[model samples]
Target: MKTTFQHVNYYWDKKKEKDLKNDQIELFLYRSNILGKDLRITNYGGGNTSCKTIEKDPLTNEEVEVMWVKGSGGDIGTLTRQGIAGLYTKRLRDLKKVYKGLHDEDRMVSLFNHCIYDLNSKAPSIDTPLHGLLPFKHIDHLHPDALIAIAAAKDGEKIVKEIWGDTMGWVPWQRPGFDLALQLEKCLNDNPGIRGIVLGSHGLFTWGDTSYECYINSLEVIETASEYIHQKIKKNNTVFGGEKIQSLSKKERLEKAALLAPVLRGLCSSENQMIGHFTDNDAVMEFINSNDLLRLAPMGTSCPDHFLRTKIQPLVLDLETNEDISNTGDIVKKLTPSFEKYRQEYKEYYEQCKHKNSPAMRDPNPVIIIYPGIGMFSFAKNKQTARVASEFYINAINVMKGAEAISEYTSLPRQEAFDIEYWLLEEAKLQRMPKEKPLSRKIALVTGAGGGIGKAIADKLVKEGANVIFADIVENRLREATKSYNKDIGSYILCDVTKEEDIKNALNKTCLDYGGIDIVIHSAGLAISNPIEQTSREDWDTLQNVLVKGQFELIKQAVSVMRKQQLGGNIVSIASKNGLVSGPNNVGYGTAKAAQQHMVRLLAAELAKDKIRVNTVNPDGVIIGSKIWEGDWAEGRAKTYGIDVKDLPAHYAKRNLLNEIIYPEDIANGVFALVAILHKSTGNSINVDGGMASAFVR
Candidate 1:
């Protein structure tokens, strides 16, 4: 049975009205922000909204403010004041004459720079001109999930005509920007009375004199379609299925909820309310128990707007377990064939539709799909996009169910569906710009990194632009480190660094996997405080194994691979300030560290021949929310220093010249600076202890 989704909520903050002034600013910012959140209405950063304002200068010059549309690359939910790039409305209208002959990229860039805004705002959205043509001040454009659903179905054009009637004008989906705007202008001139426009398989554009009116009309259009589909679609209640299930415990559910909520927040960057839903109904369970779950998973959205709402699709869960079992990597792996198939068919569809140039192919993965008994799921970047996809899915279920009530609902031809996904005009509308983060493509390895200084170096390397391998003797801890620093750039391996075989194997594996290693930070070592007289031979063996033997083994293996790359490398060791001063009851730890400090210097000289730099970061108590500081380890350390554990922070601070407790992050930064960014220095050691004014050296 085809299930339905609902538009169960709406929200507005009318009380914050006092903060706004100009109609143009208010309309533009609000609509842009809304569009940013809706996926079916927009993809990752697709879609645009705008408003025109009139401004007068002091020289008795009155001019139209033009349209302030969302800039390219900024998501609608994260749309700040700077996100909307403004352009001259009159100047834009003028471009309609000359823009035809110019290259498309130049046309947009020319318009972008001519506009005025604060120095920091996102560049103007390419669709600035389409909004410029509308008579109303506030214009809203979205690829509504419902619209996408209808468009993706069999006889989609016929369905659209039946549902929309004369309420809106329709444009065959076209490439966006100047070309799309030109197409829309032609449509407006031809159908002067039309109140709104729907770009088939693309989205809808509606406008109003006021912001709320425009917003309401946009909602109304979708709601009307939603209600129509809900009332009409029907499905049989009986099916071969499993029994109903018990509800999840509060604690269990909230944890899953938390994992997903953060992802949503990361996607949307909004403060709006969020809600989760699950079903344990018999019919739903029956559907889940069906053998067709995997086969049925790739059917895409009700509309293009689902891109903004649900992302491409939701993480479908098992009905019985209600657990997410879909492997993202597996999905990515399978998509190639589907994409190739989509591309081949798209070529034929384009040939049938027009007499023009061809568009590029898009990957095929069901952007929206029903997971058997799990009802339906939508993926979007934010709440708005999810809402849009949900609405569309509801409508799709209704229409399909309605058709099935009389006869089985037929799907659209694959070629026809492929046309929309690979539509050159729509594809052009997606954001394609790139960014340079602090870290990009460098490779680094961190030892003793289950947590603490070692873990910090691993994290920093990943953040700065390096692929990082977190190595530690604790096997479970190494796995935990990978989980903690989950990213495209992070991986982990368990290596007892003191052992030659383990060190060689780990280094060889890293080189084979990532091509080569460029930076190594040895943060693995033992820290047992003891008097020189009391320290046992066994205790000394343990200290030397990790601190001395481990460091040498790692360096030897790292240099072997690094020397081959010849790209130049950096190695950083976590030494201590105690190695520089006489501290009581610290013979074993301090002596080993002092040896490591000199070993680093010697390695720096020897490795200089191979272009691999070596350095040391002398840390002064790297304290954070790690296992070491959580219990008696912290208490013991503090007691040895004659202070409460809590006061240890202040005690360390007073010892430093800067009066700051040295964080692991600080050490991480120093390590990163010496290796990845600085580029040149080979053997220098940076003291990361906030300036310890100690004199005696080991």
Candidate 2:
């Protein structure tokens, strides 16, 4: 309830605007944007709005009364005129008689769609009947976190009556259907001049003669609710202190997170589907480290709407209390039983509430897992959904916290939760999701991803559906790279490969965000040319840090994660042609790479037993976009070979037998082959130099 109104940048398609405004749909869309962007009013997809209007009948030119209601599966903030379905007002209200004692969701939808006032309009919201039954020209319904804090309270009814006086109506919990609509209509009729209606364990509904009135009504109500909760928390002494202390400190949590993520990911991997976990943010850390987490987290989500994404309740683990927390075996042993207990408890709950022919119960596995001293993991069928679910719960945490502070948090009863979770209306919305991409749930961490070759490789992997972490020293570029990707598909960290602390923190971040790294593409290295006789000691050490020592450290950390999960993984090094066959002035580049190449082979020999494949993609003339070959360095290289800088690329390309000029994408393709398809291939060098016969080892 710290409220501020931010105007949305909007424009008019003059002709369309004039037409829509006359129908009241234009005002509906503009106000919807106002609500959608405000987090306190609605979180993501948890609200709806509508307007009563008139449209002309095409054939008769007769004015027809209609209700332009927000459609199913659309966010209130982003709703447009198309997103607002125009349903025949009287027709929709009259249809409630047919559905009166029925819980037939599919039948209800079919009838609703059939009564569209405009055939071209989008599907109306599932709660259209609720809005239609109301007498006002405009209606605003929202699951605002603050309002939910009041509605989901133990004595919610009493609190509402006290705060708003008898000017508000109270409707007890009823599944959203024709009955709920009828019950709401009855309540509003009984309380003649009510400002709003409060649905127990649900949300707020306000209506008015105009859009502006309804929007302001919602804001005032939310402010009152938020003020009540704020005072309650202050009185109870339950407000969150800034950054609470943890049993296992941040460093220790990162350490455990590195070990635990892969194991969880491995256990959750099977079939064509896989799951990744998101646990890196400050909100998750605060919740996990809090003292009352165990008691409060098990209480459930703020609303039943979250049941599908978060499960009935998260599985909680006390990692700090376990003996040998460092031993992943001990951690795994504890988690196995915890997961089973959660699964069994869910099954019992499902059986207790399921109707005789309810749809197949969702997988009993918990979607959210709370492990204090580490963090909470929100797992899902794909990376994007997993990420969205993670954010959804993070937002819910505040609402739950508010409810807990005001009164013992109250979620919908178990039977009501089951109805929403299994409703055919919701199930159809879920089924509409398109098929997963080939590499959909695979997690990859790519170093040097801010620019050049590393950027290209990262892009290719994303195209194949991998969730990628782009780690680079270029902070600005790295930030932009993460922004380009869907938040679920890509993220970044500023990293200096030569620094152990940088590498460690980056690894921990990847572990926390993605469960573990399936593919570690080591692309962080430099190319320098200096004669063996003239190479300075400083230059030698600098290049060596990047190529040899830095790569070794990365492998060391990655293997530790792979070993814990006991799942086979891939490590790829981007070595150069100079390593295989040193050119005249590439002593620094050649020496560092030779050591790095041999180190990859040695790692392959040792890690093969761990099912960790190690390989190299060596490209001789991938000069199209490689930053290593830019500027005076290329001129210097051309001078060494007694050729013009302009002709340098052709010289290297023809030196290869294939006569084709290789590109960064070609090199990426080779790396993709090794990591994605070459399961039995390890300790191998795949040359992407169009076929460099001289550099070819075979």
Q: Output the TM-score of candidate 2.
A: 0.87
TM-score of each: 0.55, 0.87
Worst 10 residues of 1 by lDDT: 264-273
Instruction: Report the lDDT tens digits of candidate 1 across residue range 504-576.
Output: 6677545433435667888886577666786899988988898888899889877765544445677888888
Whole-model lDDT per candidate: 0.60, 0.77
Poorest stretch of ten by lDDT in candidate 2? 5-14
Backbone clash total for model 2 is: 1
Colliding residue pairs in candidate 2: 36-77
User: What does the lDDT read for residue 642 in candidate 2?
Assistant: 90
Give me the displacement of residue 391 in model 2, in angstroms. Answer: 4.3
lDDT of 2 by residue, 1-698 (tens): 22353321222234654666554667778778777786667756777898988778786799988888888777787787667688888888778677736646567777887778778787776788899888889999887777777777788788888888998888887777777888889998899999999887778899878776777777777777778777887787744433344546666666766667777765555323355665646767766667667666776775755665777778776555333656667766777777778778988998899887678777777777777656777677777567657766775776776777777677777787888898877777778767777567677888988877888888888988888889999898787667778667888998899999998888888877777777899998777676778788888998999888999999998888877666778899999888999579888889888888899999999998989999998877767787778765687788888999889889877777888888888888888899778889999998888777778797
